[model samples]
Target: MPRFFCCLPLAVGVWLFSLLFFAWGTVLTVVGWYGVSSYERTDLALTRRQLVSLIITTSSWTLLPLITLFGMGAALARSPRALKAYSTALWFQFGFSVGAGAYFIYNLFRRNDGNFVTNCTSRDIADRDTCQQAFNVLRGVIVAVYVVIWLIEIWGGVIVTQYATERFQRSGGGVQFSNAPPPQGPGPVILDPVMMPPPEPPILGPAPPGRFAPNASGRFTPPGGQPQPSFVPTAGGVSLPPIIPIGQSAPQGQYAFAMPQNAHGPGAANQV
Candidate 1:
């Protein structure tokens, strides 16, 4: 199975939630900046330093969620570069969170006497108390948001690291095998011997008309309608014998005529 199948849902969820978190932080930062810039000294409760700190804190919140977005994209793409980018962003955000959290805790507890009085005004006691309460509530909410962002960054980092490792291992010569077994070391090849048909006997055509084959029993008959005597082998040497055709008369002689001309010469009968 592909690594994407296992990680896609988590990546998508992180992307969506990061977008919402980024938007929320951006809106809060923008509103706080506008409020601090527009309000007069008498109307404004927080000092310039406090306003600056608020902007810084909210801007960090806005920026940190983008790490999650980066991590999501890295996971989806399964790219080593993207994963490295996400890791850098995550560590940077984590460090920023630690610093910001420290600053906020110091200001909230040590300098402000454990009361969120940055946004309070001395002109109206009721408004001052209300502003302090509101600041406290907002501070708590931002702290929770930071915690959530931390968790998201950690989770995203783990997932991206896992996927990147998987891709690396796959690319770095990880073998995938099918049903067939791998070949062993080199060995001598044994080929099957081919079977061939026996060589054909040489073809010999029919005997000539005036010739008799060496092994034939009949006499040689020439084309002129005349029977000729032929030799038959016996215990003795060659001896002429009479051989008369059934439809022809014998010649007036003690034995039949001699062998036909050219019977055993260059125009001899074809060998069977």
Candidate 2:
């Protein structure tokens, strides 16, 4: 479920209402400034009474397309960041349109001496009735204008809501926002070969004499003496190890393991 309200439509509707309304107000403002109406006659007191309604109505929706451009740009360009202010503007415009429209319409029908109290009063003595009559028809037209704008605004309010919902669903977005592009995949992984030697068994404490061991510096200390090469013997032109098989005896004149000093007795070596 989406937790955030997407109200772009409401914002747009409110903007259009305000732009068109203020535009209508601008016309009234000019009329009051120049002190003239349809027949070059207007009364200050009566004009003020008429202005109490304070609303405008426009034909052809002249501002709609321009408003659409600005509204969508503000929304999509800045997005979620701008939504707060946009919402506030929406409410203000909507409230003003409803409040002003209602006040004006209510007073438009108010009667005074058979003349609508909130309508034009003529200043011309000679053409007073004619000027007032022209204002009467113009007033109806003006009132219709206001009603149309108000109705359109109300309809816009509802439509904008649906538009926001449909856009969200169609775009598969949450919180009434358009979807943003997904992030790119990570860069390729690299494999490196490291040359390392496997660990050998540790030599504990002090090794026995003549055994491989580490000295104080942590390097292996060689045996006390230089290493002696393996020995091989030759008998009848065949190479043999220093010691032969236990069950075999050497040939009569051949030697296997030679006696160190003498054979068996002092005279044994003399006999060999």
What TM-score would each prediction reach against the true structure? 0.44, 0.37
TM-score of 2: 0.37
List model 1 lDDT by residue over 1-272, tens digit each: 33433656544544555465456646755765576566454344544455556556655665655666666666677676666676677667657766766665455444442333543544454576677666667667867866775676566555555555555556663456589888899765443323322221222465443333322544555445555555443332334344556775433221245556557853233322
lDDT string, candidate 2, 78-156, tens digits: 3432333433444455566566556655565564322432233432343556655665675688678767766765555
Once superposed on the true structure, which residue ranges of model 1 sit more than 4 Å away at CA?
Answer: 1-25, 28-44, 65-76, 113-139, 173-272
Question: Evaluated with TM-score, which candidate comes out highest?
Answer: 1
**Residue 161, candidate 1: how far off, in angstroms?**
3.4
Q: Each candidate: how many clashes?
A: 0, 1
Prediction RMSDs, each to the true structure: 19.7, 18.4
Q: lDDT of candidate 2 vs native?
A: 0.45
Q: Cα lDDT of model 1 overall?
A: 0.54
